[model samples]
Target: MSRTLIITNDFPPRSGGIESFVHELARRRPEGSVVVYCSSPAGSDDAADPHFDLRQPFPVVRDAARVLLPSPRVAARARSIAALEDCDSVLYGAAAPLGLLAGGLRGRVRRQVALTHGHETGWSALPGASTALRRIGDTTDTVTYLGRYTRRLLSRALSPAAAVRMRRLAPGVDVERFRPGAGGGEIRARHGLGGRPVVVCVSRLVPRKGQDTLIRAWPRVLADVPDAALLVVGDGPYGPRLRSAAAGMESVVFTGPVPRAELPAHHDAGDVFAMPCRTRRGGLDVEGLGMVYLEASATGLPVVAGDSGGAPDAVLEGETGRVVDGSRPGPVARALIGLLRDPDRAAQMGARGREWVARTWSWEHTAERLDGLLGAPGRADA
Candidate 1:
């Protein structure tokens, strides 16, 4: 392949799972081999990574929310960039938005790739959005799902032929950044949690993230281990409600939103990591391969994640962490208390997690895999 153009509705200095994912992908690609058409922040003061700009040309930065009356300007801009750069492959960060925008131009690109994380298959609620996504899946050369759970769901939603072309890519972790045995003592000291087994929930406080469930289960954990602490490290729209639920509870501390840069130490301060992601009673929206679980594990922390969604693929049960019914107080509390009780066991698990991540989940590995797909792809089928 000559070059690649990654068109995305996600980018930095905007913060979210997708933004981080896109940045990782862009950063890992071989220098000067890719161009990006993404949401404008490359235009803002926050987006001052000049070295990245020198490598991956930032051609178009459009308001992702603004859709044309009929045609998508984002897609049009990406096509124009691909033409100018003579790109051989095109990558869309998400199957919705950018992928939907590229629906009509699928045939124009040689290797059209769309990545799906979760929920967007049916959660968009936009007129004709589902149809557009189907077109995206069927027409794109490969539809990359974040994990088996997402691939399974999306495969069911499209034609069998299109489903056969589906691929799965688990998001990667920066092992160098979030390694085991880092200097996490300062965070612990600052929080006054010296030597207390901390259960950290380092995600946005959304209902889907299941922070509330963790809060409800805390009392039971405290009953089992009175000195244990729950460090809720993120903030979202559910802030008021979560604070209300944890009100008057001395063990529960909400640190609001911590920057992504400062997250590793917070993970270091914890003995066990948790995010009991829960879906609404009858909805498909839930965790789509929880990357934070991998981050926690990379920091040499034991994990406790929900059994639902693509999260299971990211975590190895009975090895690095435990997967339980996070929606329920009993399971969540039991999982936390069990890990907190035996520091030796938890430390072993964390060590295993770090080792496993170093072997299997590095950003370099994911980048190499993607580069192969976009590059030589030597197999006859490829």
Candidate 2:
């Protein structure tokens, strides 16, 4: 059993999509099979990372990172850890810094893999980022993408030979943990959503997430179903704008930021999960395989996602949920109202979503695929 070194800029106690994804990836692997190198959450000391405890059984080394990638300090420490662990393989959570680092260790690391999400897929923008991505695509054993669209985006960065190395590996949810009937009623009661239909949106309050668009559509939703409640969970810089858009709407509730352990209940509390995500911040920021959509679906809540980016990959249109145009209030309003009004139909959709999640996505299954790609003998992916 060969050991692996996973270098990443993001990991918990940093709460984001990538942080959780990488944590699950390392968690499900065999004991002693993986060692992690990651950055501490902003303002927190490295010792504060929850998984760094010796009793946890895995070695988690904390370092620093830049906005786009881990700093040089992260790369230097990662190299030291690779040598110390005698790791046979190296996996970068994203393309930059670590991917750039992996390039310098071609002969040192036996197998190298880089996972590309949406933001870093654009090779032409960031200075030297294209070279970093190219190195991973050209030299690494595999370059995995979170969704089909993300893969297509990354393929643009690769040459003909490098394109052959591209692979698909989406983030998965803990189905057992986020299943239906897990204290959902408690959350509903806690939020004073007793007997009222609930629509929940869980994401950072950002322009790309389209919380403002959802708020704009809520007026139409309110006119039709007066008892309907819109719960906007999570907070960010764009929150003030969202709140302003939703001004004087009594039924619209902003829970701000909830704890992670309490998230499953939040998902289950909703009759429908809605986040009309679109390309924003001048069309650069995008949603790539929204794991939140999967989590909501896994909780047996029908989702209403955006049509842009790779959101379609997580949402099975009409099967588990609907992907609507996030820009227009008409389409967004219609989707929410339809789901809120048709309880039986919503329930049916939620049930299908639960089934789809169980059949299609799980951390265990995702880990198995990752294991095969990263360490399986006789598997010549590159």
Candidate 3:
């Protein structure tokens, strides 16, 4: 059996799309010996659950007193990889601090592959200290982008060799867990939104997510479809501002920080999914395909997303869902109104999206692809 080590900055204890991706990949690789090396905030009490067979945690710090700082953490990680007696391949989850470290160990490892989620490459120049990390991460050998647009972006940023190594790999969803026929009414009834047309938007409450844009578009949406109710799921730094934005809007509901296990119900509760992700100034904010789009699609919900970053790849324009231009609220409101106004077409589109996802984007298929890569000659050990 091949042995693979996945190095990522976040994992289960820390919640996010990258963490979920690593966890799902590890779960499906039961035939191989899989271990994960993750970074978390200091003093986090959450321990690694034994069910997954993860390695002891490694903290990625931003402070002093550590033997090796973030710059050298990859080197330390390389030593850790070397110490893994029979490991064959190292899969760096994303670039940057981890990617830079993985790149530095090119000569040391037999095989090294890097995964690039959309926003990491497109919106790296955003304000904050993360820009420095993004610069370091841009040096990986093989980069896997979530969509074609991201592949082009990375190719422009890196050399011919690095760009040639880049490939587009769509992220997968748990089909069984997030199916269309499951508990739809229970979620809606629980939230007192019986028989209402629920428009769901699931994402971190970040500036780039365009939750504010959705909020701004709500009044127009409600005006066209009076019974329409907007349900915003997940939470983040921009939560307060979003709440304030929706204060007087009776049709808007903010379900802050829903648990991962309960996420399926939230998706089931929606008649349509709205993801208006946009690029913020200074390249600080952009969408990374938005995994929630896939989840909603799997639940047979039509999507209305902005044509920016990786969203186009997930939302097939006018077929599975509508992808409007990202510049203004008018296009978004129009798309939502069009879908909500015509229930028959919306249902048809939802059914199509669900079938597309079931046939194309499941964790089993994603694992098979990754497994094929791991079984390659030099990566047999990983």
RMSD of 3: 4.6
Candidate 2: TM-score? Answer: 0.93
Query: Which scores better on TM-score, 1 or 2?
Result: 2
Q: What is the lDDT of residue 113 in candidate 1?
A: 78
Query: Which digits, one per residue and each the tens of the lDDT, describe model 2 over residues 21-135?
Result: 8888888889989898766567652445544535455887765443335456655667688888998898888775467776666777789888777787555245486666776
Task: Give the lDDT of residue 133 in candidate 2.
Answer: 73
Candidate 1 wrongly placed segments (more than 4 Å) = 41-72, 121-130, 376-382
Task: Name the best candidate (by lDDT).
Answer: 2
Reference-based lDDT, residue 374, model 2:
86
Candidate 1: TM-score? 0.90
lDDT of 2 at 6: 84
Residue 251 lDDT in candidate 1 = 88
- In Å, residue 193's CA in model 2 sits off its true spot by 1.3
Task: Report lDDT (Cα) of residue 204, candidate 2.
Answer: 86
Tell me the deviation in Å of residue 337 in model 1.
1.0
Estimate candidate 3's alpha-carbon lDDT, on a 0 to 1 scale.
Answer: 0.72
Q: Mind giving the per-residue lDDT tens digits that candidate 3 earns over 1-382? A: 5666677665565678887887677767765466665554334424434333334232222222222234674576555655563556777777644666655655556666677776566434434434443344345445667776676565566655555556555579888888786776887887789999999998899887788888888889988899999999899999999999999988888888877788888999999999888776645456667788889989889998887777788887888899876667888899999999999999999999888888888888888877665555222111
